[model samples]
Structures are given as C-alpha cells and as structure tokens.
Target: MDTHEWQKSSYCQEGEACLHVAAVTTAETVHLTESADPAHSILSTTPAAFGALLRVLRDDDRG
Candidate 1:
C-alpha cells in the first residue's frame, strides 16, 4: 500500500479521533478512513465522485 499524508477533519473535536482523508498519488482516487480504526475500514473514490457527494451533503444541510 502507498503511504499518504492523511489529514484529520477540522470539524473533529480537540483530542478526538475522527475522519481522515488522503489523496492517492498513483491515481485520481481519494482515500478516507477513521482515525480510531483505520485498519478496519477504508473507502476509496474518485475526486469527481467525492466532490459530488460533498455537494449533495451541503445541499441536504441547507434543506
């Protein structure tokens, strides 16, 4: 597996283990995982798809 510079979510509380995200250098895929159990679960998606997901989530928050 390729090593990535994972970044924790800013929305996470201080000292709380929460969502982390990283971009794959070899491809257009982005990787998402939880800081508390990174080895147990991970999600991979393309940047475009991830962007669409975020847009939908934002829209939902407004509705």
Candidate 2:
C-alpha cells in the first residue's frame, strides 16, 4: 500500500525508461514495475521467488 518505496535498478542507464522495484515487508512480497509505466501495471512476487529470479538473471548474463 502506502509503504511502497520504489527503487530504480542499478543497471539502468540514465533515462526515463527502466526497471523499478519495491519490497513490501508487511506482505512479505517484492514488487516490480517499469519506470515509464508505473501506473499501468505492477508485478508482485514472494522474496524467495524474487531471489531465485535474480540468481537466474545473473547467471544468464555471466554465461
């Protein structure tokens, strides 16, 4: 709800379009959205699932 403090991805280049994410501790969920479209939609996932996603993405970039 009101506690969503969205943060831009560190890998994002200087621009209006990029990934933004937030963690809602009360719900134990992670939230994701696009900076350029924050109002249009949002994606929510559990912390464990979000961690798995980051690991996979990191591994893909390393390969």
Candidate 3:
C-alpha cells in the first residue's frame, strides 16, 4: 500500500515510541504504525474499536 499521504499527529512525543495514525476512508479504518517505522510496520482497525480502546486507556491513565 502506498503511504505517501499519511499525516501523523503532532502529539506523538519523543521517547514514548508510540503508534501513529492515519485515516483511510476507503476502508473505513484507521491505520496505525510505529512512529519510528512508518513504512515497515502498519496496523488497521475500525474507528469504533480504536475509540473504545483509547477511552479505556485514557480512563486508566487518570488514576
């Protein structure tokens, strides 16, 4: 797959080695990948699933 137009979030801080995300409307899925390796490693999941996971993570981080 071509990854020329993917836009990563500016919030991806250094040293956390977090995942980067891109919107793929054709598939209705969000693409995820390591910020350190944009071309080599990628993952895809539904927006609903990703949002749920993000909510759970955010809740856990509050404590």
TM-score of 1: 0.77
Candidate 2 colliding pairs: none
Q: In candidate 1, what are the lDDT values of residues 1-63, reduced to their tens digit?
A: 247888877778876478888988689888988877746478999999888988998899899
Question: Per-candidate TM vs. native?
Answer: 0.77, 0.86, 0.70
List ranges where model 1 is wrong by over 4 Å: 38-40
Candidate 2 on 21-50: residue-level lDDT in tens? 899899999999887875748889999999
Candidate 3 weakest lDDT stretch, 10 residues: 1-10
Q: For each candidate, what is the lDDT?
A: 0.81, 0.87, 0.75
- Badly placed stretches (over 4 Å) of model 2 are 1-3
Estimate the TM-score for candidate 3.
0.70
Q: Which ten residues in a row have the lowest lDDT in candidate 1?
A: 33-42
> Considering only N, C-alpha and C atoms within 3 Å, which residue pairs clash in candidate 3?
none
Model 2 alpha-carbon miss at residue 4, Å:
1.0
The model with the greatest lDDT is 2
Q: For each candidate, how many residue pairs have backbone atoms clashing (under 3 Å)? A: 0, 0, 0
